[model samples]
Target: MVRNSRILIVDDVVDNIRVAMNILKEENYEFSFAQNGGEALRLIFEVGESFDLILLDIMMPGLNGFEVCKKLKENPTTQEIPIIFLTAKVDVDSITQGFSMGAVDYITKPFHAAELLSRVATHLELYHSRELLLKHNINLKAKAKHEKNRLLSELEDSQKEMIFILAELMEATSDETGKHIKRVAETSALLAKYHPCLNDEDVDLLYHASPMHDIGKMTIPLEILHKPERYSEDEFSLMKKHTINAYSLLSHSDRKLIKAAAIIAHEHHEKWNGTGYPRGLKGPDIHIYGRIVALADVFDALTHKRHYKEAWKIEDAVAYVLDHRETQFDPELVDIFQEHLDEFITIAISQ
Candidate 1:
């Protein structure tokens, strides 16, 4: 496609320029000519992008074709412009040097007009085909990106449907209704929305993901999870196994949402001071998603009516969390939480 376009001829000899221009003219090909390497370099720099191919002479005064080709190769803007050497130099070393300096082909002097025309045509066709292949590659990348986004959107919708179903199953097993998990999910999303480190996507993921925090509880028997009395030592140990069960349930998937869900399931029960879980993970040992869900889950449990206890006042719930900052929560995260406490309460009340 590009070979059918403009070609530039560079040589100092007037007769040679006339002959080459005439040969190309009969085929209706457009062309430009420069007398010497210096003049050709100037013309190319000025309108280089328009020229598809060049016929270069190697024996010109003040910057020979080899020097010109070397200069063209140095300028990134003109480096890839193909050059065909039209010169008298026929020795093996000179021909090798022409290619080394970046000329695409060597055509010796006293040249046949037909051979020159045919070589020019072949190089131009190859250049145009390479351009077409590059365009196709760019289109392929864009199409692949579009398909990936579509698949991700479908997967997110499917995961939400599964979470809702799983939440219902958990509610069916426990004395507390599904509203508890729903409230926690809403509250966690609100907290993440106002958090400085989280973006809109992170907030949305946390919203859907936080509800699955107690999914491990599905493995705990109804007697331990729903009992209206304090748990015995053996029952408490079995109760703690819920975290591992939750991790097991969600860990095998490669999906990002499920991976996040697995992390929350395993670490939400972990305390900041290394004292409150089957693993006793401390401080940053807990992933940020787990820390965020921990605060949301505990706050909702404190402020909502439960089978075993009455709901505490909103102020009381806040005070309990603030007082136990380093012991129960990451101190730095608690500082961010305290700054956004009012908003958290508003979201809780609204929901």
Candidate 2:
């Protein structure tokens, strides 16, 4: 309905061109004419004159209307320009060929002025509306992608904050330092990266979740948690319940990181030989996340001085891990630990 819509008219006869222009002039459209199909193509292609609709005559000398329509439809730039065959060829074959060639409609030589105006207006409106819809869909998809990324970022931030807060609460009640938690997180992530079954995302999840392995220590009394001497039978029994306490506290969450933390907290103490506590799960029956963090937590704990024990030398810690393999730790995880020993040493020394 916008004023001054541009239209291209191609006809060998000057009268036919003039008639279409005259009939359409009252609609306030700008008109361009070509005597042959070649000129119409030149004006549309070489000259780059944009048009809303094209009124093509079928019987032109060079590059007849059908050929022009075919070429125009093949071109991506001009393909969407609506074309109406304005000619005297009213046979079924000619009409079928025109439609097949991508002409929007066909009009016999003497078109009614009212019909021409109505058809042109209808097709132009349809074309513009389609263009608007395509753009809207593209913008909607882009906005949805942006919103999804923003929400994911916020969720990840919240997970990290929750992990640190709970980990620090455990640290506050026990001898574990922030550095121990950091080293455990880094070592767990490093071990997960080299594990055959785990992917990068799994590595990241373990990295964040490993720090909460002792989150249950927050529930232990300071007398037991910070005891300077080895635990007696009853004291050790009560101490071992920290793992169950951590699982109980964390397993209620539906969040992935928290759920992974729950598994690590509960199973990090389990021995590969079924000598470990809580459920006596052994070997592959243990979750990989639990198996990975168990090794990391012990290695870091042994290298660092605790209230109950002096820090063993790094070499001694490594020997202890190798010695305890298959008894206290998963065999495969111990292999990973030995293979990546240098990296673990670097993380411990740096942190």
Candidate 3:
């Protein structure tokens, strides 16, 4: 006995509707009644979720049981409420049509109180189980999504820590301090933000990857990096190999940040016009990341004093970059750089 369950009885015969009502009265169930299909639909809609099960009369006047059943099933709000056909027609075709119209079961006229109650109880239990299962599925999906996001965040942090450790190793062996890589990361991110082709995620990737652009410089002799004068032609040739050396160090990693770092390390030296060293990739053939980092590296190099050179004036360094636009940098990137020139200047000056 489901004391809280509600049933709606739709019948043209007043005595039959009263008889069904009386049978359920002893069970402490709630009841609603309608004289025809039209009245049943109106009462159901007006009461809104008032009935858990519907005992529908097939031969009612004005929108008969089949039509009402079809309408109820088509409506999302009432579609899941189970329906049972209470009809005089016992033919196979009528029963089949009733089931097809969304009836859970059919009862011939003069149904026993036991038979009616049994069918109602069975379908209500099934409906309640399905609803519970649906809620459980939704909760499981949310939990799984949250767990997936947590793992991804941890993995990103771990990768970033590893890259920074390697970057600091290179900085320790060179004249430049950590500030050089920090400026490059910030400036590159700003430039990437303004570029239409790079989304927010790409901008973030560039910031982390740009700092490791010179990790290969760790392989160079400290004497060459710390020299008081410009490199000899032979020394310069050897210095260029640090680009290839960097590629060799970081290229093997399958991680996305590391892979991006490898591309920057290998191709940042290559120029847009193909006059640059190493692979000599030209124009669009060179990765956009390499082209982006190239400007950042040179800008930082010119504005900061190294053992081999004094710091250039801000205006002088800006002139050098714009002068080499297509010859050394991506032309469109250079245009974006010019638009955000003041922002880059601020970053370069800070620390």
Candidate 4:
């Protein structure tokens, strides 16, 4: 007990409260008295935050101290207030019940003055210290969450910047604008949403990785890349190396986006029927990312003019894709592409 500290005494018997108050009145502590559990609860609800500690009597009329303690412990605001049970029984069961109901300590009736002061002082000190530690832990968790969100934002920006720069690098070989890469990425991501194999992470990785599908073209000679006529066999062989070159450029990194990009670059040229170049992988042998980028790249390339070819009509390009289903492209992917024709057209127009 200390000066200015509020203590509540709840007992049906007036003499018992008088005895406890007299024992600690010399210390200048403030006191409040209640005749039963109901009165104690009313006072607590009215001004529980003003109370530093409570000296409660277990045996009472109407509501018992155990019931009052349970109510206090269940409340968010009053739960932290230290409770000391004043019991006459001194039995193990009563004491266990008091502590179990969230009492900090229990004192037997006919209390000694020195013992009362010591227990009160110790519990008050422990309670306030625990409150300080709780506040610190809550603040620490808030700051940690804020820092985690900031790092994720930075990583997202880094991925976008890297995708943009690499896409431009690949398009520079043929002297075309980088919008082709952007359109391919958007189309690939849109088509991927229909895939059973891809989750959210897979969709995001494909969107970022698809832009690098033609990164191998950056290694090809400007003459071959921009030739007016069809490529000679030797020139075409050099040109076909772009896919392998793309894989080589991206395969060194273990990052999810880069690893997916490597696979796309490596197998995008492989045909569904084993006729296309590089590895000549067919059907399910090609990774899904590869198959997706292959469709995206060819679709965008056909609808737009290139150094070697004129742009085909949208209908003609789409018909060509349908004609080669399961031969030049994955069959299901072609179906999805046809199903979402309007969306692809809108993307082609917008991007």
- Which one is best on lDDT? 2
Clashes (candidate 4) = 0
lDDT score, candidate 3: 0.89
lDDT digits (tens) for residues 1-351 of candidate 4: 245678899999999999999998877778999999999988878754368889999999889999999998999888889999998889899989998999999988789888888998888778777877999999999999999999987887797689779789768767567889889888999889888778888778788888888888889888888899988899999999999998888899877778888898899888899898799898999888888888888988999988778899999889988998999999999999999899988887786
Native-referenced Cα lDDT, model 2: 0.90
Which portions of model 4 show Cα errors greater than 4 Å? 1-109, 113-115, 196-200
Give the CA lDDT, 0 to 100, for residue 57 in model 2.
92
What's the C-alpha lDDT at position 305 in model 1?
76
Residue clash pairs of candidate 3:
none
Worst 10 residues of 2 by lDDT: 168-177
Residue-wise C-alpha lDDT for candidate 3, range 1-351, written one tens digit per residue: 456788899999999899998877877778888999888988878656468889999998788999999999999989998999989999999999999988999887897999887888888788778878999999999999999999999999888887878888799898888899899999888888999999998899999999899998988888888888878999998899999999998889898999999999998899999988798789999998999999999999999998778999999999999999999989998999899898999999988
RMSD of 2: 5.5
lDDT of 4: 0.87
**Residue range 274-344, candidate 1, lDDT tens digits:** 98797999898888898888888888888887777888999999998899899998787678779888877
TM-score for candidate 3, residues paired by index: 0.83
Ranking by lDDT: 2, 3, 4, 1
TM-score of each: 0.86, 0.74, 0.83, 0.72
C-alpha RMSD values across all candidates: 2.8, 5.5, 3.3, 5.5
Over 4 Å off in model 2, which ranges? 1-109
Residue pairs with backbone overlap in model 4: none
